[model samples]
Target chain A: MTTQTKQRRKQALLHRTGSYGKGLLFMLPWLIGFCAFVVIPIGWSIFMSFNKVKIVPGGFKYEWLGLQNFRDAFLKDNNFPVDLITYFQEMLLMVPIIVIFALMISLMLNQRFPGRFIYRALFFLPVIFATGQVLSELFVQGAGEVPFIQQYNLETIVDQYVGPELAKTVMNVLEKVILILWYSGVQILIFIAGFQTISPTIYEAVRIDGASPWDSFWKITLPASIPFISLNVLYTIIDLFTFPQNPILKYIKENMIKVDTGYGYASAMAWIYFGFIFILIAVVLWLFERTMRTRRGRS
Target chain B: MLLSRLRRITFFDFALVLGFTALAAFMSLPIIFILNHAFKPTNELFLFPPRFFVQNPTFSNFEQLFLHATNATVPFSRYVFNSVVVVTMTLVSVIVVSTMAAYVLAKYRFHFKQIILSMITLSLMFAPETVGIPRYLIISGIHLNNTYLGHVLPALASPIAVFMLVGFISQIPNELLEAAKIDGASHVGIFARIVLPLSVPAIATISIFTFQGVWGDVETSTLFMQDETMRTLAFYVNSLLSGLQNSVAAQNVAAAAGLLMFIPNLIIFLLFQRKVLETMIHSGIK
Candidate 1:
């Protein structure tokens, strides 16, 4: 290359570095917070999980205990494993239901209609009340439950018709419908947002081509919203797992406060639980990516 | 044929409207139920087949709530003050920090931008509960426990806020920034005068979210603020509910407290619903 071209390239590189430095300077607060809050806390938790953490007169002491804490959580502690399995089972059922419901509702709300914003606001209303304490209190007070289900003796009726095990499962699913619907508020908002991103012209074109609404939904809307569906899946998973109602979190909270099962054991349980969540998220991302790739290839 | 088609369309729209109305009523029932229960007399609360409407509404619940607050050592206003201070501090800091960082991520081409963005995505997957123990450890270790900073600092750097702000700021026209730069605007000057002013809707959206999240939070406040006076209203109400179970007066007070905690959020939502919805759509576009 000519000398002038080389000099121009060098100047461009310098300019890029300068911008990089400026960007890093702007990101200083987050970097500091990430280190102090996230990085350090993660390291500390991992360190503490392998030790026996004791609270004393002033602060606490950590005595090295190797893999005993992990072993205790898996084998010695019955509640942690049961809680973890129950959480996984619940997530397996709830995640798809929440996502599909959100998608369906968003699709319904996305249509051009008068008072659309009112319906949107109505759907999003649960977000205002779906906080940890409020929801728990509402449930405790019997306000949040579907009133007629128990009053009508539906579970017993189902039990008589179906097998006992299936009846129990069906009843559990039925009971969770309200909870699931409430949890879908944000996901519905997200899906509505995603729905809005698809241009109207595509739908118009699909209509002119004689495609039915169902056909257009599958062909155009679903493919276009794949990214958002995955996003909602990740969100629903995280939200469900971390929700105040989660038995695993309740278990962790119970253990964290007690003098007998202080920070070390709780930290160990948390790490194990986090491992499950991480794996779940990874599998979700992988599945979505593969689906998207296949869809792209087909088209 | 045209008349028939128009009639069919109207019928479809009618069905759609009715369906949505029913769903809306179902969604709003809990809020209505809670508000109604707050007004019910002690005898009415236990009425079978549970009336949706209060037959004889009374202010006794509110009076009882106030009485209970007064009987408590710290008083109700203290919890309100604590919530206000912590939420405001966290809001101000989050806006300043997240906005600047978002501007850089959006407007500037930088090394490791992709990495930083991916890191944020990864961080979003980590549940707060998973980190609760270590978070408490850090707060106590830094001697911030029982202080507002302990309550505020851990949540100040919200990844979702940063992500949303980045999307919002990126939508601001580059030509505008270039023109401002040409007029001798420094980075800070451009951010303060141009980006910040143009991004009010986005800022408001984040503010409402941060406010609601911080206001409704109980676990952090409970963990950090051991002192009764420093606890937030949510934590206080939670404690009250647990401590005074089965008493009609306590139940009344709990419902009242729930309404009290909910009112600010409702007002915010009503005021900024448009802006918040617009921002959500815009973020989706990105």
Candidate 2:
């Protein structure tokens, strides 16, 4: 009876704490890892952004530079701002295309079919070889281009409308559509995993209620997958922004290594780049959350 | 009615099959080139017009690759071994750490939870390489430089993995977790017996990411370590390219190495694809 009373007091104490302690306990390892790896470095990066860093005997020597580095990135640097804008525009087009394609292919691949696994494997193989140098090599060898694109003389017609300069950019992206497919592998895997969470019984029940495949897709399949879609959108943006061939990254390193700009300027450029991405991601997440809330309210 | 409808082949299905076939054929082009190019002798690699298929396939490229590997200061297999150990260790740590944290973030309400969540989102904003100098310093400061810990430690804090797992783990019903609580299970028990098993698909997805990142890793090999023996196979392959830049023979040998390297990635994907299916049968419970 005394032991039972002791257990009851313990349970009451636990109820008061609301398992916050347990949550922290579970998150402990990652918390330590995060503080060690992420927090310190990010703090350093922020500090570095405002200071001139010189390589000394054992470590870097910092000389404070107020906002000069930031000013240089915005006012003095030509390529940094232009490359950042171009990357943003490219991602705005590419992210939606990749996500939608991932959804479609994953939906199909989720179906029961003969040789589906083989098809899935084939679609994903490019990701393995999509490492930078080899892909560029393949591109130089004309492997990423659709052969019919040139034969069709489509660029001439495109040039008539968008003008030559913009048309050339459009044509280049069109030619790299195969590489876009290569980029969708992770998105596809995420979508498929997400599709697993939706129960078949719900589909069956909806079917019994006389919904067509198309109707069920928009009403049932889509709403369930929105979170995964948002996740993919987030991943896609980050992936494209830091693309190995991204001129912005190259520009940052080039400026960092140069005597004129050095690490201060590069860090400044990086923070500028990060600020844009942070705003874009925050806005997208906010918009998505609003939609999610509306969907929940309707349900 | 649904089963019968499925049995009937519609023109829509036909169109879908055709579309998928076309996409697959298009996707397979580079793979075909890689497969054929790896077999071609040095002369054929640079043939004018660059023949799509090798007229005379040879194993000489593989031979050259192995011979070069053997002649390196540290044998090629040593680099391969280093990569395997690092990749395996990193994958295990990343999955375990990320999933445990994800379970809490997804289900538990705690003080500063919002901060942890935002921290993850923020980490994803900046490129990792931007912090290279500081991260290297931290590694060296911890006295982990030139060791496997340098390769494995930083990667364990994988925000994307945690993000993906939280997304996946959130799909598991709250009532189910509550039910386990009523059954007197500890957090560790619930995590091991329920959360881990239920979230196999997410694990598989993150495993593939971790494997690919560590396997093809350039930064760790180039940045953290001063010793050549501690470097990975990817660094070796990269060194080969730079060492023999502009050589036709190097092209074939690099192609051979590229082909060999990508197989592990492909196999990992295929293996995980099967794991993605394991939870579907049990997860229908809401």
Index of the highest-TM-score prediction: 1
Off by over 4 Å in 1: A1-18, A157-169, A197-209, B1-9, B110-115, B247-249
DockQ of each: 0.59, 0.43
What is the per-residue lDDT of model 2 for residues A1-299, given as tens digits with 9 covering 90 to 100?
99999999999888858688889988999999898888998898889989998888988889999998899887887777777777677677778888998999999988866567777766666665676546654654467777768778988988998897677567767877887899987678778878888999999999999999999999999999998899889878888887766678878876777876777778888888878888988999999999999988988
Q: What fraction of the true interface contacts does model 2 reproduce? A: 0.52
Candidate 1 DockQ score? 0.59
Scanning candidate 2 chain A in windows of ten residues, the lowest lDDT window is A132-141
> What fraction of the native interface does candidate 1 get right in terms of contacts?
0.57
